[model samples]
Target: MNNLTNVIKERLTKIGKDFNEKEYGFLNTDERLRTPVLITLGGSHAYGTNIETSDMDIRGISMNSADNILLGKDFEQVANEPTDTTIYSFDKMTSLLTNCNPNTIEILGVKPEHILYKSDIGEELIKNKDMFLSLRAVKSFGGYANAQLYRLQQKSLVALTPEQLNAHIVKTLNGMRDMLEMKHDMKGIQVHLKDGEIVVDINVNDYPAESIAGVLNVFNKTLNDYHKNSVRNEKAMNHGKISKHAMHLLRLYMMCEDILLKGEINTYREKEHDLLMDIRNGKYLGEDGRPNKEFFDIVKEYEVKVEYAKKHTYLPMEPDIEKINNFRKRMNLRMVEQITKRR
Candidate 1:
């Protein structure tokens, strides 16, 4: 194991948060409503950005009983918060994948070594991951990055200047992309100074509505946060994790752009390690220890790239719903067959 990997594993044990499969006793229920299928490292560790202070997150999928599938009983997931473990039912997992949800989607692409356990069905699930790739990613990933950007903006130690406001709009525009095109036949939305006031000209038609709403939601929250003014600024002074949020904000854009542009999941972020670590370590922070324009400049670069990709992306307009349903049935049928043999 690498030194960093050892440190992370050792850190988990030191904090008394280390775990084994046996510790997930919910898996032992008589009905087998949540049988383990796959488990993998999550959060920073899975992304290869974990530091010594990073917390461990274990995420996975579990196969549900035949009755739960056929009869529609409610067995969604079990959350062991103290241990930071979350395992979703196979059905729940498939549903989430249909939307290309970032959190659950990444679980399907974790590095093999990071995957602690996998049954035959789990392997098959990974093999068919491409079925879930679709244009919905334009909304899913960009939305996540926008949410992160909003959080970073919220806890800023100062009020938003016109320039900073421009950055926010641009970053968010990147996240929403052509989705905003629906709003106004958006030729293109760009934040610029008209007499020292931030002005956005949106030109779009038939863009994605949900993604546009997500951008507006974030902007509203940020505007409200600005209203808090000095009180929020003071609180921001003590907030050291803003850098981490900033790093993730940029990283999400990178990941999403890759998904839209290259048609890949890229969970570990091996090639971008140095740049991501620099951001995480505050290389892009200004004297106030807040994310500076330099970081936003980089974010803008990725945003432009993602826009170009959105127009020419090779991914489908939606997931292969029929295929996804078939795979779920196949996995669940194997699950039912297991129960039959046991009987």
Candidate 2:
């Protein structure tokens, strides 16, 4: 198997090992009086970021058992209860219905190859690609948007410097770019250095520097916004890791906006936009890859102090003698504190 397949297997193995064996049988219980469908949501599976210890995110949907019991009487009263099947499992019915929904279709379309498991309900939905977007996809995008917002909130409360804050945005954007790549988009937008100058490349059809100037302006403005008004702005600080804005989340938001403009979520927009700008300019790709100059600068500033702290577990400077003397006075040590005897 290739490296990617191996990585997936490793993540799966970690999940299997972490799962409580006793809980595995809980889904099969008939306490709900209906069949249930378990759908895998985000994580390494959905994002293709699965490392070891990745937990599988799942959502359960049931129709036949619950719906038939709760709404069956109404159905019977309306249709006179046909003999073939007067009632159906709520889980089964909802599962089937979701397959044809546009939102559902979108969710299914995201890394279908990553599906670890699927029951009969899943198979049925898989066959109906029409519902993939109308029923399933919107929620996926919504979930991503929510995640991004959450991270931005988290990074706002940290002790990060201006450069650290910029790094946070850079990393976030890179994450989103990777997500776009997974959608089979052939183009990419990247911030990198070329011949000692920062340049944003909007590559189209594998050609770098298509619309370099336009892309650079967008990237520069985005970067400036991140530095000036990101979590570090002090006006919008959060108390968690998310307070640090994620550039990837911002990129995802941009992609989503484009999708909304097109009246649908089409992954091709990323590829197309990326390529459109690529044809406008020709520039060499940077080697550093990540936008981390600010992060490194912050690290350098704190290096000396950090080293001192590492060795002493505290600040290097001594305490003020006056402050110590004042504290001693409070402790009744004002008298006999100094003795000047000629010996």
Candidate 3:
């Protein structure tokens, strides 16, 4: 463990809470908040993406019906922003997610990772992800996936680099490998990365690495040139969504680069990460939180590995059957919904 990780663990324990590595990594949902919540942490840092000198970000979620008497009148105005159809109270956040509102729900949708410091209801939420993942509920909140792709394309066109191009390609391939692994046995795929020529992994009774690498290289070059020109010629507002899979890989590459460069990340300085030049320049948010010195110290004492930034590559023998099906389902549903809504 590094200095920051140990500190975070200590802080959580002091506050009568505990978070495993995965839990800590994705930490900004309603599940982590305390009921009658007071925000002690908010933004990217709390979401497990922090770098250096982060300004400890925090926010409170509450019901609009209750004017948040606990946080006082001054905070009431800040808490007024609705995350969606329902209003979320955030004026005087301490260390909780006590508010239950439509706006809060919407915020939850955007903030994929969050950790609450205190709250009975929030703890209950962690126990039951299914409640929040209803297909109907998410679909009602607007097209989140579409929005993500649109933003990604804009960012990529403006600031892509050679490193980012490579990262994007490798990341996409790995995603395919993972999905296939989860749903099917490793088949005939063989893979190799460019430049390094390192075989990150190999699996195959059949198939050839040359074929896979050829296609990947072709796509990478095309996308690279496309983005480089788009960045120079395009205005930000005129951009639209790119391929969802491709966009995700683009963003993930940007983030991984941030992680590798930042080194240390904590759970209290999310806003600082956002304000960083790298982030503003279209880099991904990584290590955007404050340090928990004590917990960080303990992790180092134990010599635990916190793998926040290492790059990975994977080779698959066959394409993912499940992913193809899921993609079709999602695409079809999205198309129909968009048409119906327009009508």
Alpha-carbon shift of residue 118 in model 3 (angstroms): 1.9
Top lDDT: which candidate number? Answer: 1
Note the clash tally of each candidate. Answer: 10, 65, 54
Q: Cα miss at 100, model 2 (Å)?
A: 12
Better of 1 and 3 by TM-score: 1
Q: Each candidate's lDDT (Cα)?
A: 0.74, 0.37, 0.34
Q: Write the per-residue lDDT of candidate 3 for residues 1-343, one digit (tens) a residue.
A: 1333344455556644443544333223332221232223444344434435433443444322222233233223232122211113333211111111222332332232344333443343333322322222112112222234334433444344556544644544454444333324344443446674324455455555565565456445545655564655344333321222222322333332232334212222344334333433333322321112442253243222112223221212223435434433443344335435666
Supply the TM-score for candidate 3: 0.28
Best by TM-score: 1
Per-residue alpha-carbon lDDT of candidate 2 for residues 1-343, written as tens digits (9 for 90 to 100): 1222233344456545243333343333334412333233343234433335445543333333322344432121101121111122333333333322222233444444444344455455445433222212233343455445435433342445545554555554554444344333345677544454444565566434444444445446656655555445344432222212343343344334433333233322244343222211211111322214443343244334333333442211222434433432332221112111211
- Evaluated at residue 72, the lDDT of candidate 1 is 70
In the predicted model 1, the residue pairs found to clash are 179-208, 181-204, 181-205, 182-207, 185-203, 185-204, 185-205, 186-203, 186-204, 187-203
TM-score of candidate 1 on Cα atoms, chains taken together:
0.77
Better of 1 and 2 by TM-score: 1
Error of 3 at 18 (Å): 19
Which regions in candidate 1 have their CA more than 4 angstroms from the true location? 1-34, 157-159, 162-230
